[model samples]
Target: MENIVLRRVIPSDNSCLFNAVGYVMEHDKQKASELRQVIAAAVASDLEKYSEAFLGKPNEEYCAWILDSEKWGGAIELSILADYYSREIGAYDIQTTRCDLYGQVTPMEGAPEEFDQTIFPVLQDRTIGTVIEGCALKLVEEAQRKRSYTDTANFTLRCGVCQTGLKGQKEAVEHARATGHVNFQEYS
Candidate 1:
């Protein structure tokens, strides 16, 4: 197995999504404001293309709001950023084990070829983290491997009635009390 580990970049405040994008792009956190400005400008420059579905407001108003430092970036902003940078953006929810992809703009026939860059979003609560597709798969695999070992190693009790596993004596007793299943044996 590869010893690849994902690096985390915590946001200074509510601009976590923007900061994560900046980190993935090899930019300093301080540059997040600038990145936001760039995205806003791109949206402003092509109001018709963005439309209400993407911006969720009048093009001008959305542009202004997005440029504000206090504003949080969401799917709309991420989609715009993806197009502006010609990269794919992925958001991962670790607890739910889900990942959503954004920014799949079709290339303009005559435009320059887009780079295969991936941007990740780290959720505010730190319960979720995102990375490129390849890295994300690695993370999922590692998590599953660790989970299998943890499940087997930590479970100390088994209910004889249902053959259900329990983590400890307390859980075993509780299960028996709640389910009226008195028979249990500790697994060796």
Candidate 2:
């Protein structure tokens, strides 16, 4: 028999990613605030690694931006959290039907030190890619190419900051640049 993987649903708040990770690691769903703080501290402590060039914004700006409770977190936050907890994270993107993996591997149960230090990351990365490539992800991706997925280019969006309605990613980006209001919600 195969092990059934069950998902523990998290809230739909902006901090859902943090809450989900917290729940999985420590059985706590309300750790978003704390997790945000952790990411801020981690990024601040290592400006060299999390520089403006890498983060697409000033390090201080990113730190401050991420601390906002309404700001949504992404790969950067998950990578920081994974490092902080010393655990590999695999985030499932329901929209894409994909799992984005993060963090440093700590070796298998009985692996040699040399292999663990040098080859594990590469191996795991390839294995995950191979698995996804061999699975139904191809079908989902094909459907997406066939126009089965939502046209994010023209989806309805509303600025959560000022109750301003907008259309699609282009308007959303413009709104954020103009008003510095990054929080948004999709509307039908």
What are the clash counts of all predictions, listed in order?
A: 0, 0
What tens digits encode model 1's per-residue C-alpha lDDT throughout 1-188?
Answer: 12233434355465877877765565444666888888888888887797877667888888888877766677777786777677767765443446674221212323321322234345686443333355566665565555522232356878888999888656866887799996766676
lDDT of 2: 0.70
Ten-residue segment with the worst summed lDDT in candidate 1? 104-113
Top candidate by lDDT: 2
Off by over 4 Å in 2: 101-154, 159-164, 179-184
> What are the Cα lDDT values of the candidates?
0.62, 0.70
Q: Write the per-residue lDDT of candidate 2 for residues 1-188, one digit (tens) a residue.
A: 11112233467787988887776666677999999999999999999999999899999999998998877788999899888888777654445667574211223444432322211233645874354333334444554566553455798999999999999889999999999998888998
Most accurate candidate by TM-score: 2
User: If scored against the real structure, what TM-score would every candidate get?
Assistant: 0.52, 0.66
Model 1 residue 123 distance off true place after TM-score fit, in angstroms: 29
